[model samples]
Target: MNKSKSLTIINLAEKAKFYTSLCLGTVAFVSVFAFLFLIPFVVDPAITSLMADYDTVPVTCIATNHIYTEGISNCSWSSCKEGCTKEATRCHQIYVNYSKIPFREFKYQSHVSWDVVETRFLINPEGCGYPPSVNCSHFAKQYGYTTAGTPFPCYYSRVYPEMVVARYSWDDTLRHLVLSLAIPNLLFVASVGVLSYWYCPGCGRTCQKYMHHFPAEEDEYEENTYYNSQSFTKIHG
Candidate 1:
């Protein structure tokens, strides 16, 4: 009886160790993946904002009324066509006129278009109506067009086009940021789960071995749990 109890305790200890190791391994795996994928979002504002700004098109493209513009941010304009669902409809219509600024390293051309799109969730429709208004007066005094500090200079046109600029709301920016972050995170989690499952086969086998020993030890302790019935039948014969 004492031997059987000792065996059971040893088995339990082994099983516990196996399961603990498995759990620690899984946590470590997930931690590594989280650190790798979550770093960029935390470190760089440009990268974090990159997704949010994805929907914004260049003021130059809007000025010319062109659907697409070279080197402009691309986005689905339809989602905001009616009105933004979240926040205060932080949407606006941008009217950028490039002629007023002085051209130095980069040239500025006055080519513009217009749009009444929701750029963010918090914008009030009262102060900013459905067809948002464009504010072009801010660019008048600047020597050169604001390039958003781009390495390449702003495109200049000799014709002095009255380009209409369209400014995007902050909500669209957030939407893209969230979508971008989600993609890698989901992939990381799936990978960690798969890896955890792959590495845990030994745990199941160990538990099965422990359970199989239970009946044999129990019979020994009870003396006739398994053999008593058969021996009694023989005696009757």
Candidate 2:
């Protein structure tokens, strides 16, 4: 009875392993096909977008220059007024704001990094002189002028800020998708692995039963041979 139960368990485990492997193969095949089919629509566009769009805006600024001197002070109030006139203006004031467009902003400097200053500025990597330079107070001061604070402003749409968009990255997107799928695949594979491993114990018991029967069968055969030999000798005598 014990042997029979062992044999039954072994058979069951073997069958379970076989079935589990079949199911895993089938599912893996289906997943591959689905991945291929859905990639053009679901993954391709996301990949293209993540890298292309960053915070950017268009603005116009007018250039101007202003000078003051003691000699010019004696020119008269009318002359001072004339100095402030349109023809004497160094530049015109204009509407220059990035808050109206989509952009991503970061702190100009951080406490962790001592090499920089904290400020707001537009990130324009392709701007004329320098790559990834901001038109912040520091940069402005180099030109012999200064703005009190908030050199770079977020582009405002209505009363709110716009969201910055960028090109999609396959690594980022696929990494997330893999993470979401990993745990479930692990659980299922582990379950199947356990079932597959279970086959040996029952097979061991069945083998033990067959081993025990072999010795008994050998003993019976020996006894029958001795009897037959004795009977043959008696008949010959």
**TM-score to native of every candidate shown:** 0.25, 0.29
- Per-residue CA lDDT of model 2 for 123-212, tens digit only, reads 121111222322323333432234332333332212112221112233555574564455445655665555445645776688789999
Q: How close is candidate 1 to the true structure, as a TM-score?
A: 0.25
The window of 10 residues in a row where model 2 has the poorest summed lDDT is 119-128
lDDT of each: 0.40, 0.40
Instruction: Report the CA-based lDDT of candidate 1 relative to the real structure.
Output: 0.40
lDDT for model 2 comes to 0.40
Kindly report which residue stretches of model 1 are placed more than 4 angstroms away from their true locations once superposed.
Answer: 41-43, 46-66, 69-237
- The C-alpha stretches of model 2 lying farther than 4 A from their native spots are 54-237
